[model samples]
Target: MSVFLAIVLLSLNVGRSGGAIKPVVTFTPNWGNILYLDDVTLTCDVPSTAPEEPRTYHWYKDKRPIPGDQQTLHIIESLGRDSGDYQCQTIGGDISDPVFLNVTERYVLLQRLPSLIYEGDPLTLRCHHHRFCKAINPKFYKDDQEIKPSGSDSTFHIPNITRSQSGRYKCTKQIQPCYTPNVQELSDESFISVKELFSPPEIKVPPSRVIEGDEMTVRCDTRLDPLRGGTKLHFAFYKDGWTVRGYDVSDTYRVPSSQLEDSGKYTCEVRTRSDTVRKRSDGLYIQIYELFSSPQIKVPPSRVIEGGEMMVRCDTRRDPLRGGTELHFAFYRDGRTVRGYDVSDTYRVPSSQLEDSGKYTCAVRMTSDTVRKMSDGIYIQIYELFSPLKIKVTPSRVIERDEMTVRCDTRLDPLRGGTELHFAFYRDGRTVRGYDVSDTYRVPSSQLENSGNYTCEVRTRSDTVRKRSDGLYIQIYELFSPPEIKVTPSRVIKGGEMTVRCDTRLDPLRGGTVLHFAFYRDGRTVRGYDVSDTYRVPSSQPEDSGNYTCEVRMRSDSVRKMSDELYIQIHELFSPPEIKVTPSRVIEGDEMTVRCDTRLDPLRGGTELHFAFCRDGRTVRGYNVSDTYRVPSSQLEDSGNYTCEVRTASDTVRKMSDGLYIQIHDYKMQNIIRLGISGFVLSAAVCFIYFHNKW
Candidate 1:
């Protein structure tokens, strides 16, 4: 028995003269530490204070009895789950306290992070083997070749990784002789891939906001760059968590008529030809709206009287394509907002009064959209039950260049209706034609200034009670006059400034109203056109040379007219610049310079020029305001073809210079001969020393 077990027996015997001996666990070779791929042995021991034969002993791991016979347990190879607290028990003696034993690994393993590490990104490789002891003098290898000398490091790092770094990598861990172990060395290997393209596919839809009955196109916007590798990509389109189409090479999927069911979460999946890589985009939700036309409201009986009932009806000429037949209605009295809200299509006034004598309007709204159509207001007047003092306008819907007439109804009703009434017309609370005993107001041709709310007041020549009619709102459009773009100096240059003005003339005889101006270049509105009449460019570039025009919108009538496109030509000094080297090629001890020529002799008189030189896509000389790049000392390293760039003061219209090849030849014949003679003398002296030693 072990000394620890004997001690436990003595303690139990001393405490109680007739007590049972305690049970304990023991390990073989006097060891308990376990390692991966290592074998270990265990035994259970029990003792009795009495001098009789002892009972049987059993072994338990983690306080649970395992299936086995005898008093010993041997583990051939320790695994991760073998680590636990062990105990032993006898028939009568108390079971032993838990004895903790941990199993660890010693084999080397290669690992990498679970994140994407693309080319040009920092990369790291780790060797996991130093669990029980330190790995001394570790070495890293690539493609079975040593990359560095043996050092005490387990991690290899590359600052800026490139595609060339893709290869099989491995690491070696050396166990120095001083360590007490059978293992001498360990190695781990893994393959690494440096990706160059890792971007996912993007999705788009034509007609961003879709409506029912519209032709729709759902596109997966991914195109291969011709300059890159030739890798075929397969596309898949998905909607509402299910594949709509798959295994296709095209990037777009078309639908003849997009409906409400076509709108849902949409996503696109892009995969490589070999299916080795895949990427999916996030879902995009779409909603399709219905289409509807403007609605109109009808008034019955054509007239209203005080203390009489009347009905107003709102209706849409055609129903919308959107679902559901239910609709909502809203009415406005004077300008707008007669009441909060109403859902009935028919608005009935139980009793007409003078307060309800103003203009009335109605509109119909679909439940799915906030868009609704507003009907032109209809005037309804409330008069005495039998009064005949009435006024109205002929040709109520009058456009520009049209005539309108305002006439008071002179025919009196058969029952006490007023007659012989003087006429007074008021526009927006101001009298236009006073009570001058006239019954008609006529306009030969209406103008934009004639748009206003008009009302008429009439009274019999015998009665003093003046009756007023409901107001009528009219809109008079203005005639459109296209504006023209006027460029100062008529001609523009790339490096020079120019001013652009929008000029138009309205009817000068009757026009003092301000006009809003806007400018356009190639049909797109230019900035600062909303608040300014003229646009100016301090320095123009080649991109600013396009078709330009101006637009004039009438502020009062909201009438817009566009001018003809003007092809603006901006002169360029460097159409196709040329680069030249005077001698082209030279030997050592020759002076050289690269000249940049614009080939525009006529425009070079007052032009401010700048020059630059480049080699191997890198700048050799930059931002030099000169036309010539003189090389101080021409050498063989400067023999590659050089490119030059010539720019003007504007710096936006620069031209590239043709490549100039400069070859430099060596002229060191004498120096070569001197080196040969020196080498021969040194060889002969070494031979003479060897022969002297032999003698």
Candidate 2:
């Protein structure tokens, strides 16, 4: 018994040892020190101490079981919500240590505005802590290079500023471990620009001369950065350093109307808004002159023969700058400078003609650094002794449809007697025709298709003279009259057919000839068959109701006589049906019916007929009828008056009644009543008279 108990205890011990599972969990994270707004994963794994079924795992936060029983924990975006301590626990009895997370913010702040310092002026830059209650000692940096360590209040001060002191400056807080050591929390960079103080503004172009009424401009510029409050600067112009009549402006001043009093030394000065700096330009001297005088012109022997040489001179008396002044002489014809001379005194005009007769002027110029002044112009004219030759044409005006002749004649030259001469005729500059005649030539009217100014030239042994005659205008007349047209069946039915004819008297010039005639309606030409004298327009439509005309054109070519318009109108036709009453004889108080029939196209639908009952000349009753009409009559009034009319697309017809009368017995009751009333009235009057006498 003891030996058997020992065996069972060994088996039990073995079973207990085998069923005890060794649970293992491995926590693997995607990252260490999880950052804000990042995803993190915590994976847990269990080592094999085999159980009969799969073991379940659960995740937890700060030792509390998560909602789902999952071994792997997934954190989507790590915010403050997911920033607390995180841990995972398994159903098989394993747990993980808590993992802590942290969040931080980064930003920048401004402590002061950018400033400008004049030369030798002190400057300062101030920066404050970016985050509250943080142990941060700000460090100063210039152009990203460490300059000095700053105290609790990050302020950088410069004792004196020069042009080299201008640069970008910033301050940053120092950070320690957990982040990079000395991590900069930068402050907004400030700019410091240095300027020079109270340098007199430079003046330019002194001793400048300008004529009165001419524009004069002077510029004053300084080397200062305008972007650093440039508009706040004030500029003043002074003549010899005393304030002149002008307002303060930037760099330049322009005096459009310069007077003689404006001649002086000018200077410009610029002042800054802070009163710490000012600049002035170099001095400029300007001289103003009076209005320039008009130039004088001189002509030698103003009177000269045509084709003879002449001399013309132009000179300017006033010279702005003395010493060998070179004057420019320009010759003009009709106000246009044709030739110019670069001479000190005079210019020669060669070979003068009537075309060379016009005003001439000359101008003198002085060479100066400040201004270039020109003297006023001088006027001169060249005269010549010659008269224009005269020309005439015979039969200047020509009438249409008549024969014409043209002759070219010039002034007779007596010096050259009976000499062989050459004559040429021109119409529009180009020679039309030429002939070797003594003096004149004749042109036929058939050759004068165009009319314009005609010119003729007669050549002698020594010279050739040409003259232009007055313009001759030629007129053409309209000799033919428009053709006349006529048509048949002037009126047309709305839907009925009709025909038309267009006729005209043929012209004698085109007699016995086959002429093509066309018909026109509206603005469009209508199609029709043509004859020598007339055209037939057939099968006309309603649209053909308008003015129609005929054209008598030559059949060989379309260009021929066209006729005037003829008016025509088409009318709508209405046809009524015929109605007849049945039974030649009728008695009183009987039913009678009339039938209406029309011989019109079936397509012309919805035609109405009017029926009336007339006695003698008066109508008793009237009504409209479609195909058939019925009437119940018993009296004589209904028997006498009865007529029916039918209307259709082309005609209207009225049917007369057979004039039947109904006979009836006459009654005497009405006459008996009238006689009895008259007898009673007489008896009453006799009785009244007797009673009155007895009383």
Candidate 3:
């Protein structure tokens, strides 16, 4: 068959060449396989618009001009020898692209894809058999080598294709359910080409600092080769591996309002007309800032007294991701400036005063931003100072040994309640007690030493305006020893005047001092409150017999001194009392009584008198108002000297008793002699009677 088709092609080409200039030629049914004995036609084209212009065709096989007939149709019969690449030229010098023709008696076919491809692209090939049946497990090869697909598919697909994959490629497939595994059909040869028309997309942002509610624009740009002109491009934006915006034909994108979620790793992708050819850019950091909270003013100690230290601070809440933002602070007092533009938040006052009081506020914001916030107002009030004090003494009339209170009173403003005050006490233009914060000073025990003109000094914080009170006189008295009562004779007869004097031990240290005198008897005042030292009774009487004491004091007496007591006695006349006994010569068997009486004292007028009767200088009878002595029977023992005494109550003025003597005789001895004479006469008669009875 090959020998016969060669002979037929040689006869057709004989004497067909040698045309003028050049023209274009083509075969009808421009693409696809032509089966054996298929009717085909060719046309010779010329660029000249005139129909009368003469034209001719020139044909070539495998890039060599062939001598063919000048007719426009080149026909192929039974196709074995006519299978080749053919090009043609017109007589007017126009050339045409060569087209390939292949004819085979085998029932297998191979399909080819586009020859020109971008670097990042995919390639596909299809193989078919004239039997019109499916084939499984197809294999493809480049330059007679096999192309192994990554997965199980009959058709071959090369993914992410590059320029290195360019070569002649062919594919083969076995008939499905065939008994022999080695039986395969071959496909027609085809060439592949690769061109670098893309670089990685570069992403950029005009403004690096993007906050919430801010508009942002993103650009993904790529370089292109002029040789790949008219290539279509698509763009995509990605965040953290997820697509922020799907691929679109536009290169740059706009975001109206960026949010906190928009902050992350961002990238862009650029693509050619083919979807598989694309470049992704490196990640760009896009951060969205959050707004900062309003500033607040803080005071360390809310309450403070005058002259105390305090601290004020300004603060705010912010997002930590604001990498380069700095916070600045300013303080205001009642709309006036206190501190301006201070980076530090704290302001301090070492000592607060009344003039330093007002409403306070603080303003804070970021240095990079124009917005700032001012805090609410806080108040600081300074109290008026405690000053111009006065002194007061308790118990206006203070006596010796009396406890006293000295108070230093200062004017206080209730608005400033925390004022602290210090005070001191003075006496006789000298400090009596040290300075103390307490306003009251107490004298535990007041003595003569405490007697002086007293004053006080009140102060707050050293009493810048010192004040003193008027002097107060405090008088006291000293205690003296007891007074003495002296009498002229010390003893006085009844009915006579006696001199009595109240004498005190006058202190030599206080010589010639004016003193007051008072006299007391038995704890009762007798002569009271007199300047005279002597307290004399006009006449001394028995009633003057009592205990006497004297008291002495200064003219300005707050307290007095009492004297030891002395007893006084006024007596009667020295004559003895007379005594009398009834029946002075009474016999021994008779009853007797005795009586004695003393002379009554004229000074003791109407005073009840007491008397006693004495025998042999001893009291033997009554000492009562009844001044009589009596015996029931006069016996020999009752015959003795008898006397009586006279005295008043307390036995102060008593008189001695007078003595008397009495005699007595025995009456029974005389009656016994007469009885003996009568008994002798009776004895003579008894002797005569006894002699007569015995005979």
> What is the descending TM-score order?
3, 1, 2
Residues 1-695 of candidate 2 have per-residue lDDT tens digits of 22212222222211123234323222223223333454555555443344546557766666777766665677665565665556555554545445454322233332332123466455555554323234367777888787877667666767555667777777776544354445545455556566664445676642365765557776666664432332355777889778864546566677766666778888887765444445566776787765544456666675544344667655445435533444454555445666654544566546655556655655443332222233344444433232333445444444222344445554443433444446666666667667556445444432324455556665544333333454434332222234677665545544445444445444354346565667778757775537645444444445668887777655664335566777777543334444456544544445565555445434444554455544455654554545555567643444553444444323333434454332321235546777999999999999999999999
lDDT of each: 0.68, 0.52, 0.67
Candidate 3, number of clashes: 12
Candidate 2 Cα deviation (angstroms), residue 141: 52
Tens digits of per-residue lDDT, candidate 1, 485-596, equal: 8897576777668788887765544376567788878988775346366888887777888889887776653466678898788776556677787666666667778777
Using lDDT as the measure, what is the rank order of every candidate, best first?
1, 3, 2
RMSD of each: 52.2, 40.1, 21.1
Task: Kindly report which residue stretches of model 2 are placed more than 4 angstroms away from their true locations once superposed.
Answer: 1-294, 300-306, 318-321, 331-337, 344-347, 357-361, 366-384, 393-454, 458-695
Candidate 2 lands at a TM-score of 0.24
Residues 1-695, candidate 3, lDDT per residue (tens digit)?
12212222222221223443334344554323454564456555443432565556677877888776464665756376767777777664545555566656554555543123557655556554544344655677789887664234645766678877778877666554244455444455567666776777888886877765457788997876553444578999988899989889888778876666778888999876557676789999888776455667787666644456767888776665654557788899889988887778877877666667888899876574354668899887755455445667776655544577878777765655565666788889889887888888788756667888878875566444345667777664344445778987666666556777887655455467778998877778878888898887765677777788888887877446777888888776433567777776776777776666566546445666677877788778657887677777777777777778876665645676556777655668646766877787789789879988998
Runs in model 1 deviating more than 4 A are 1-480, 528-531, 600-604, 617-625, 649-658, 666-695
State the TM-score for model 1: 0.29
The number of the candidate with the highest TM-score is 3
